[model samples]
Target: MYQRYHPDKNANDPKAADMFKEVTFSYNILSDPDKRRQYDSAGFEAVESDNQELELDLSSLGAVNTMFAALFSKLGVPIKTTVSASVLEEALNGLVTIRPLPLGHYVSKRVEKQCAHFYSVTITEEEARAGFVCRVQSSDKSKFKLLYFDQEDNGGLSLALQEDSAKTGKVTSAGMFFLGFPVYRLDQTMNSIAAAKDPDTSFFRKLDGFQPCELNELKAGTHVFAVYGDNFFKSANYTIEALCAAPFSEEKENLRSIEAQILSKRAEISKFEAEYREVLAQFSEMTSRYAHEIQSIDELLKHRNEIHASYTITPFKRSTSKSRSKSSSKENKEDGQTREKRSTRDRPKKKKWYNIHLRVDKRKAC
Candidate 1:
């Protein structure tokens, strides 16, 4: 490049003190192989990372405001600002801005006054995909039907849709879009900006009265439909939008999410029901055991030959020796019977204690 310096120029006047001089400074231009290769292959977005503050042209800024004012005239706004040359200069300085995206309208297919095919664009505060282009989709793209034509073949289908449409298969599209690359030819480096036609292209400039030839192939992101003819072609770029089913698809997504929540809640209720069934089964087992214990206690209480505090003793004489011997046998038999009766009473009393504990649950009081 060059170096900056002050040179001696004035002799007497203070106004002509030392004048600025241009010094030729030698600089070796260097390019890294990795970065150079990436820049060559990447899309329009690749270079924007380093260009934080895009260069502003005063004239282009004025043009953007002029276009906005023309549009607002039909918008029926209550207040309008008067445009002064000085105010325009301030607007051009960056008070108002043309974002990466812009306000767009649907290109009317009415070719009587307007272009035959045009783009219907929805404007919002969002960065548009650079080089965003669309092509006419065919009606019956069963097999890959390749079609291409230049200005020589001015043939284009009216894009007729089918009867059972929107369910399956490509319905006819009413518009056309840039099927090729979307490189912008705006020379922001200069003050003037326009959609530079191919005449300005280097190769097209050299040719006189030349018709451009384009090659159409199945690319990665191209949309497709089927047409009856193998070849029907027109060269001018056209854009249109198909009416998507029920606008605001984001709302539909919210409904789907609500349905999912309902299903999840139902699953939780089912799980609770299953857990309740398990608890009921455990309660049933406990109830069956309590019933068996109650039956055992009932049998013990109803035993006919036993009663509490009653001694079983047979009657016998207390005087004669033979009678006394008989009395001893009677006494032995009575003691054995009494002992058996007492043990039964004590064991059955445990069943009563079990019943008491079984009825101790709070629900039993209720």
Candidate 2:
């Protein structure tokens, strides 16, 4: 409708064009389900009010069920929590017998490497309640499995950074610790940029040496691992093996990793700011220079217009009998008179008769 009723197309009546814009705005809002729902349910005022509320809550019932299952497994008790809808009443009644929820044992397991171990990690149930960390050794230079989960329901397992691996997890090492994070590729075509921007944030969280695994128990798929320093390890034909502990001894490591990330991000921002300033300064300088040039051009154009106007009244003439120098001198005198009228206060300046002749020839050609 806008194209149909644009003022240029429908000079007789353009009011319909405004309606087209309004319709487009309404359609944009209605296209999004959340925005449409907010608009329908609460109108524009309520939508604006709701945007300020950001608290998110999720049910812990699923995790509770997993905890119960893990506990039953450890105790050598075989039980299934899921029941048919018909037995729902029976299940609810049976729950009365178990007094408060039970916290399962925080299991800490250690794997040893043949090489001299420089680090060891230990995490208990208290740590696993939220999340925990562990370290594993990589025996293969090109490829190695870091996590193996036999049970599909083993919970989410997160593999943290390789501490002593060929990679340097520390940020200060080479400004490339982000490469340490575990990445999953659907195919070989995947590059590091794609892996970093991948929506599967579950894998990227471990770039820091301090992130908790989502899987309560690390015993699912055969997971492979690598580090940024793999190139060095590959050349040396050496492997990295380190001990890992979980749930963290305390939150200090987590805090430190987070701090390091913040600092790194800040450094990047500073670098960008410096570059931005330099570009901005260059742009400002260029803009000023352009403005001065434009002003000079405008003054030159005004003088040219004055000369053209004088020729319009006086008309052109074909000179004859005079020497070439005399004809040139006569043209220069006319140009100087025009310049004098335009710049009366300024002293006489050198004139370019060639430019005037060229411009006049162009006008004649046109």
User: Pick by lDDT: which candidate is best?
Assistant: 2
Worst 10 residues of 1 by lDDT: 20-29
Q: Residue 164, candidate 1: how far off, in angstroms?
A: 21
Using TM-score as the measure, the top candidate is: 2
Off by over 4 Å in 1: 1-254, 266-274, 304-306, 309-366
Q: Which 10-residue window of candidate 2 scores lowest in summed lDDT?
A: 171-180
TM-scores for every candidate against the unseen true structure: 0.17, 0.24
Q: In candidate 2, how many clashes are counted? A: 13
| Residues 1-366 of candidate 2: C-alpha lDDT, one tens digit per residue | 334544445442323422332343354356447868888987866444322221111111245433433332233221212212222232223321111111222222222221111221233444333333333333332211232112123322223422223233421111111112221112111122222243332233323223332333322123322222212112212232222233333553565566567557656765666777689799999999999999999999999998777856555454553566697999999999999888876767668877665425555755
